[model samples]
Target: MTASARPWVLALGLLTALRLVAAMMLPPAPDEAYYWIWGRALALSYYDHPPMVALWTAAGSGLLGDTALGLRLLGPLSVAVASVLLARAGNALFPASGAGYWAAALLNGTLLFSAGSVLMTPDTPLLVFWCAALWAWVQAHLRQDGRWWLVFGVLAGCALLSKYTAAFLGLGVLIWMIAAPRARHWFRDWRLWAGGILAVVVFSPVLVWNAQHDWVSLVKQGGRAGSVGTGSALRYLGELIGGQIGLATPIIFVLCVAGIAVACRRFWRGDAAAGLLAAATIPAALVFLWQSTGSRVQGNWPAILYPSACLAAAGYLSPRWHRWRRWGISVGLVLTAMVLLQAALAPLPLPRRSDPTLARLGGWQDFANRVEELRLERGASFVAAEEYGLASELALHLPRGTPVIALGDRWDLFNLPEPPPGGRGLLIRSTRRGEAEPLWPQSEPAGEVSRRREGIEAERYRIYNVTVIGDGPRKVALPSRR
Candidate 1:
């Protein structure tokens, strides 16, 4: 390793170590628990997403057991790898000005990455493989070697397995090739076609799984494309912009916007490297931008763009805007630190409703234990929840091998075992929502519990002792055993 790269290595190592410690200290978010259940029940694909996250979670938890650190073991480690790959890509693309180090630093400084690194999600693996693919693409260009195409194909395939958003990477590559005169000749390369085939091969299991399940996963995700109408377009657009700004942290967001603008200008000026980065960014960004007009665009959906965009931003800001770059990193790091502290300690006195950290992570373990106590008191055969997240959280905290069934249509599509008919269950639902009357034939309010953190109530749940009738309202044929 070069002398200059050593400091970055040490810095990233320290950050990753801190993240791992935080992972152990922090509670698992509801979605993390939900995905943990996915890890327990391995599948080629799931109702909501591909199986990569499940695989990642399973591997981690298998090694560490089902603790928070176990569930999140790979997340920080993957980000560390991603940072190195991104830095290498930046260095190869822009040799001078230490743009590589800046790219890695800026990425780690982002709230989206720094704070998110402690929680395991589909985005974790998605970001890692996405950066790996970008690095492979850079190597392919630098070496003019067909073998790198195969590596790119594998990485891209892994990215696709991680999330459907990675399809944009392929689209970005196509756009880059078409727009760059020098890259156009690669159209005749047989290896390029082979690489495309390889990606499809790697992703084929998901396709087969979807086919077996009547295309449920594809149809469910594809349904997000429909427009909700222009009446709320401006509202959703503003939210999308605001969400990105907050998640990216304001100054880093501004830097990314400026960098993208610079990259676009350079693309027109025949800078293929700049074109590559811009192409990787713009297509996905435009889709999200347009989607915001018709529907709610999730803040994390744009995460895939950051790997290449951060590199571009680093190249654009280095030397000329060094002061601004430092300021952006400082602000992002500060914001990230605050978020991490909040998630770990809940020291801030923000209202439970206003603090997402409290809303998502706080009191779940205690709440689960309370529900378990109620289940025993009521002699219930199983504990059930109307919400999937609640169900998964309960599963994570309840006694090992306890039955925690999620009562909803989405659960019918999962490979999970169905709740036994004619058995009594403790049904938990949000107090704010009306009762699910049709779900229980004989029902009586058993108890209530409040999910609280730091003396503030995040939410309240009403529990009912209900005798299940037949298969209940949300039932379907039990999914075939895998």
Candidate 2:
């Protein structure tokens, strides 16, 4: 590596090492455990997301076993690669002002990316492939080479496999091609059409999987588009903006907004690079902004916009903004470090409801152990929960070969083994977020367990002794032993 590249590599390597340590230190969140179960099953797609996260988890755990480090191994590694690719893309897009290194640093410093790097989730793979696609597109535009389009296509396909939200990226690219005068000529390029075809071809597995499953996955995710807010639209919009500010960190969010405004001005002045960045971000930003006016938009839903947005922010030329950029990174890193520490060790004396890390990641192992003791005492054949997250967590922490059943309709979509008819099991129901009723007719309160982290109770669950009286349609299922 060149002398200049060495610092970037070393810095990224150190950050990755710290993330891996955090991954190993903290227990898997319920969502992480759910995705880990997906990895165990290895489906073409899933009821919630496409198969990329499953594939990534499977690869990580296959090599490192079912440990937290194993399941989350790729998250940090992928983010490191993403940071490098984003740096290159920034440099290629704006050569002056060292926007490349600043982009990389700014991205790493963000709470969304920093905290996300240690968690095995759909967003993990999506962010990496998103950066890769941006890099490929930048190379293609700068070199005016059609071959890079093919690379962009593959990365775009991978991003789609990671999450359905990736469709917006493709939409943004189309807008750029149509709106930017310099890029309009690509409409006549055969390779451009070929690249589009290649993306669809690569995404065919998900289509086939959905086709076989009655397009259930597509229907489920697509339904979110039609949801309207029950409360005032302004309330939801405020929440959405507040969430982004907190997730991005206030100073960084300010930088991004300022940079986007600058890019918008340059775009109308016929600057192709600025237009490309603006086009890539505006479509998704507007969609989410509109969605917030109707329904609650997830803070992370706009994650795809950050690669180009950060690049734009890094490229913004202003003495005052440059000073703010430095402070932004410093403050962001401090906030990120605090979150990591809180997740790993609940040092702060916050209430369980107030501390998100405690609510999601705390006390799972202890909770599983207590549930297992109850199961054995009741002579139950399997353990069951009405929630998928609870069931998946039980599956991860319960003894090997223990049958953990998710008593829900979604479990029917999985290829796991059906629960035995006329069997007895322990049913767990959370008092805080209970959604489903008991499936079995014969159920009685057996015990109650409180999930606690650092002496603070996060949740309370009631355990029931349930005996299946008949082979009803609501019967749960369990995965076969690996």
Candidate 3:
């Protein structure tokens, strides 16, 4: 191997191994368990996200065992893959002053990647391939190699299969092809056409799934960034800013903003590489900014931009800005260290209001154990949870070979076949915003139980005895999310 490649390769390998250990130690987040459910019922895709997370979870579970560690093994490893890809992409684009290491280090320090690594959500798969696409673009465009175009096509398509946010990659590609004289020729190139076709082929499964399901998934996701009613827009924007600032950290965020400004200037000055990176990232970030003005946007909605944004930042963060760069890296490292220590040792004790991680991931195992006892004592043949997140947690933490089904949403479409139809099952409904109000109005309330963490009620479930209808027990229609 080349001298330069060795350090990166070694660092990445060690980081991957350490992250894998953390993945094994930490409890599965609610979303992780929910996706685990998707993995077991493997489909082309799902109602919420594409099939990539499900595919990863299924592979990890198969390779390991059906445990928390097994289900989440890929989550942290994906971070390492993304970091390595970011390093390579940075080198390909900036190619100065160890840009590769700086870019990877900067990205790793971002909470978006660090916390995301253990979460095992849709973002993990999206990030790994997003970096791949970024590197391939740099290789294909900046290096003037046609072969990497095909690789970019595959990775970009895979990014889409991971989440719909990848459409922004296409938008950037379109803008670059239109705005950059050097990129314009690609419109007539056979390689470009071939790459486009390949992307469509890779994404065909999602399209086919939508066709079969009346395009429900597409419609649901498409409408998400619309208006957030009237007064909620400012509140939503504030939340979005706070979330992004937290995830990226203030120093790195400032660097990214400055980098984008510098890239815009350089692109107008006929710098093709700068234009490529800016066009590929800026539009996606702006979309989130604009969406935040109208609707509540998730913090990670624009994460696809970071892979290129980090490299863009590396382009201008040079010896001239050494003090600023050092400060950013130093503060970022401290933040990262604190987060890693918390994950590795234990979460800090805080009030339930301030401790979402504790309130959510902490009490689930105990909650499952108590509910299992309730099922046995009440002679309930099966267990059911009101939401996919709750259902997935119960299914994962409950006794092995047990079935915990989701009671609402399109869950009727994927609920596990545990006690079969007509069986008397114990339904677990939380007291969230009066959730138990209309729960099983037709059935009798058999008993109730509480799940607590540090003497605070993390979750409370009212158990009801209900016969599984032929179609499954009736549940109130879940409110439309979008």
Clashes (backbone N, CA, C under 3 Å), per candidate, total 0, 0, 0
Task: Tell me how candidate 3 scores on lDDT.
Answer: 0.75
lDDT of 1: 0.84
Worst 10 residues of 1 by lDDT: 473-482
Best candidate, lDDT: 2
Question: For residues 284-396, what per-residue lDDT tens digits would candidate 3 score against the true structure?
Answer: 87888888887878888877777777777777655665556667766765776566555444456565577565656666777888888888887877787676777778878
Model 2: per-residue lDDT, tens digit, 91-207? 888776578888888888788898888999999999999999989999989999999989989999999999999898789889999889999999899888888888888888999
**In order, what lDDT does every prediction score?**
0.84, 0.86, 0.75
Span of ten consecutive residues with least summed lDDT in model 3 = 473-482
lDDT winner between 2 and 3, please give it. 2
Q: CA shift at 27, candidate 1, in angstroms?
A: 1.0
Position 68, candidate 2: lDDT = 91
Candidate 1 segments exceeding 4 Å error? 229-231, 435-438, 474-482
Q: How close is candidate 1 to the true structure, as a TM-score?
A: 0.95
lDDT of model 3, residue 191: 84
How well is each residue in 1-482 modelled by candidate 1, as lDDT tens digits? 98898988998999899999999989999898889888887888988899999999888988998899999999999899999999999998889667889988888888788888889989989989999999999888878887888899999999999999899989988999999997887788988878889899999889999999999999888888775755588999999899989998887788888888899998999988889899999999999989888999888999887778788889975466678778988888888878878878988878876788888888877777778777787788887777777777887888765676666677766666656577778778887787556355566887788888777888998878876566455632221101
True-structure lDDT of candidate 2:
0.86
What TM-score quantifies how close candidate 3 is to the native fold?
A: 0.92
